[model samples]
Target: MVYPPYLQRSWQRSHNLTNAQQEALEMAVSEAERMTHILQNLLDLTRASHSMMPLQSESLILNDVVADIAEMTKKFEHRVIHLEVAPFPVRVKVDRNQLMQALSHLIGNAVKYSNADELVSLQLTQADSWAVIQVSDKGDGIPLCDQSRIFEPLYRVDPFGARSTGEAGLGLSIVKHLVESMGGKVII
Candidate 1:
């Protein structure tokens, strides 16, 4: 979707519009982007569930993958995303796009639940045989009763949760499927 940049260009080119008109356009654009995000999530969930998501596996630099995603997510503008990873290339075999989607979902989750001024951290570290990517936030932790159900399709932690903030509950399910399909483990 041509979201922010289009909205931005419109704003820059619009000099005659009143403040209220400008605000209305901005809000409409925001809503469009939100709907696009939700629709994409639903499609991804369907693909993941049906085992129809294709994998184009390649050797990828882990740091590059995470850094690129972090850069793109900076446009969110609501939460502070702190990405901590070494500049040295850490290599892994996986479908890069799928992995990016999974990581994006994790980062999005952290950003959504955490307060606007709070920090959301994404840390990457390598163990002997596995790469660990941890996403943490300062928000209230998930309830013990809901922890096991969080990755299930259509399951929401709190009804008034992040989905209310513009995401559908399909994200974690898509994340789980994508990671597992790429032969990696997802630990919440």
Candidate 2:
């Protein structure tokens, strides 16, 4: 995340620049933010794989977790994202923070890849002994060939696709690691 002070400094300086200069500065700032996001995701993947991050497992109601994530999604997405869950309670044993991170990765990807008008849905259902949380998007799905490689760190469906978003392809890898660390499996 970009620091507030940095943002403050940037905003304070932006007033002095010409229109073209200000636009350039804004683009630079966005690139820096995307780089920061990539680096953080890399660090998270490393920490998760090496057992450096602690897992604080608890018996959490699946509905509550989904609600919390839905709220966060609404805030981050700044739009009307969709949520569908069973009316009844569904409980699961997992690390709330870790699970939240994983689900956020999934939902965040949904929002990032899809268009503004498209619906990104987070659906929760209980299947036998397991609780399933599915994030579905209307974006063009990943290429068949790329699907298998997506879980690999630094792998992108189309490498040139990063030109627009500056994504370093660490999201899915971190999600996979985080979910597995909590004894839960991630399905693409």
Candidate 3:
């Protein structure tokens, strides 16, 4: 789904559209693609959610996944997604695509909410028995009051705003559910 650059520029320049209008237009074309992605995620989550997803449990390199996400994020063009991987490779046991989906969701959100030039950082580290993957962004961070409920389904932080990112609000919920099902925890 391609949004014509001219339309985006015109929308961006229009005072009548407001920020929300611009966001809505950008999101409209992306909605189908995002929903497709969410559906695929839901399928993966269904397997993992029900403990039916098979875990390969091989020594997997974290750097590879981070690299893959960084490369994939390049398509966004409007955002600058960065990776701050540890100097050493961190190995873990997990399903590669599922993990990638989880990280992709994080990176996706970072890109969605952030301004074009903002930085989104993906960090990987190992501590004790757990391997940690953190994706942080410089966008208006989740509001203090809503932090607790951000993982709830259909929850939108800016539901009525024109600049709002159009999410079914299921991504993080699915991420949380899938992670816990996989014996890993998700932190916002």
Candidate 4:
């Protein structure tokens, strides 16, 4: 993701610079943040794949957790996320922190891949005794042929770096690791 250049105060504060200079500085800062994000995701992917950290699983109210996640999505993503919950509450056993990270990653991915006018939603329901949370978006989807391998670390649909972000392609892998660590499955 191209994170905002929040760290560069001079670019935001200085008014004396020429228009060309401002644009150039903003571009440079954005590029640097994107690169840094790639590197950080790479490190996180490695840690997720290699580490055998004990999962601190616990029972939690699924509705409450997803509600907090919805708020977080709106705040950080600056997008309105539609959320739906079953009439009855559902409880789930999961590692709270990992579940949050994985769901956030998936929801963020939806936002990243979709247009502002498109719909992005989180649907929560109880299937039998299981609590299910589905993150969906009306974005261009992965080719069916490549969908099977998306959870593999470093796998990218755009292998030729055709995508604008030049991402390291570790996002889904990290999400997979986090989810599976708590005995949860990712259906996408």
Candidate 5:
């Protein structure tokens, strides 16, 4: 009786994986990571919606935040992020991590929906006593009918697109909650 199935004489163990097999393995890993990200977003949504975590608000410069966001995005997605910020320091009190996540989601959403050649821009400007942050992209926009509901939790404009991107549609909802938590609003 063979104690271990791998010790069978007819069984051959090849140390090398074929190119297709290797690619499949890589794809599987990518999918797994994507799923993990989705789960984390879900947790974030729950926490934000329920106020389980309080805002860790602090004074921050918008220019530095935009610069860091652009640099960080470059590592994850191959896209040009055009940043426009006020020459003067635009300071705001907010949770840095949440703000970064919100901006990153906007930029990532823009990149996902737009053509590779299309432009994506993140702009920060001081308007009156308020600091305005906007993310714009040249992409096929949501239908007017769906635009009003886009920020609702799990509301996807295109389910197929969400499927490919592995987005559970909690991004905009989280953005809304986080921004509101810091006494701000998102205007699209």
Candidate 6:
């Protein structure tokens, strides 16, 4: 439920603007669909975490999920995301939306943290019985010491100061819970 640092900064920056300017700024902020998407994701993750089991389970194609996430993230002008999907459909039995949520969080994080004009890649393939999806970024990689606990709820790596990347720190924790609840595993 925490707003990203960018949004907060924007609000602060607009506090002294004229009425017309403030209204226009608010409208522009409202027009950005990413906030709505992130809020919905948070709500969905909350519901899933509290439920005994995921609500829906079915066979799904992971490539489609990756493509969808890429499409959404392409809206960010600063990010360059690349998709290397396998020729065949990478299918798995799971809740489509849940998996999409997990993948979206990971891919979104990659795009958010990546250096300007750098590429973020989504690679998908099958490994044994598990469908493997890897989202990689070429930005400042996670530090070795903090890697082990990044999945903990509300544990921000750069918590003491301003965050260059706008994240609420709940995304990865939610992904980990959702993946584990479905009897699958997520690696950092």
Clashing residue pairs in all predictions, respectively, total 0, 0, 2, 0, 0, 0
RMSD of candidates 1 onward, in order = 4.4, 2.3, 7.3, 3.6, 6.4, 6.0
Summarize candidate 5's per-residue lDDT along 60-152 as a digit string, tens digits: 998999889987877778788888889999999888998998887888888988998877888889889999988888898889999899999
| Model 4, span 18-73: residue lDDT tens | 89878877777777877887788787777777765567889888899999999998
- Tens-digit per-residue lDDT, 78-174, candidate 2: 8567889988899988888889899888988888899888888889999998889999989999988888899999898878988787788988999
Candidate numbers, best lDDT first, in rank order: 2, 1, 5, 4, 6, 3
Question: Residue 160 in model 2: shift from native, Å?
Answer: 0.9
TM-score of each prediction:
0.78, 0.90, 0.72, 0.82, 0.85, 0.74
- How accurate locally, in lDDT, is each candidate? 0.83, 0.87, 0.73, 0.82, 0.83, 0.76
Q: Write the per-residue lDDT of candidate 3 for residues 76-186, one digit (tens) a residue.
A: 555666777878888877777667777777788888888777788888888887888888888898999999998876677887742345456767776776667557898
RMSD of 5: 6.4
Q: What's the residue-level lDDT of 163 in candidate 5?
A: 67
Q: Which residue pairs collide in model 1, if any?
A: none
Give the runs in model 2 whose Cα sits over 4 Å from its true position. 1-11
Candidate 4 regions exceeding 4 Å error are: 1-19, 159-163
TM-score of 6: 0.74
lDDT of 3 at 183: 73
User: Model 4: what TM-score?
Assistant: 0.82
Residue 167's lDDT within candidate 2 is 85
* Total residue pair clashes for candidate 5: 0
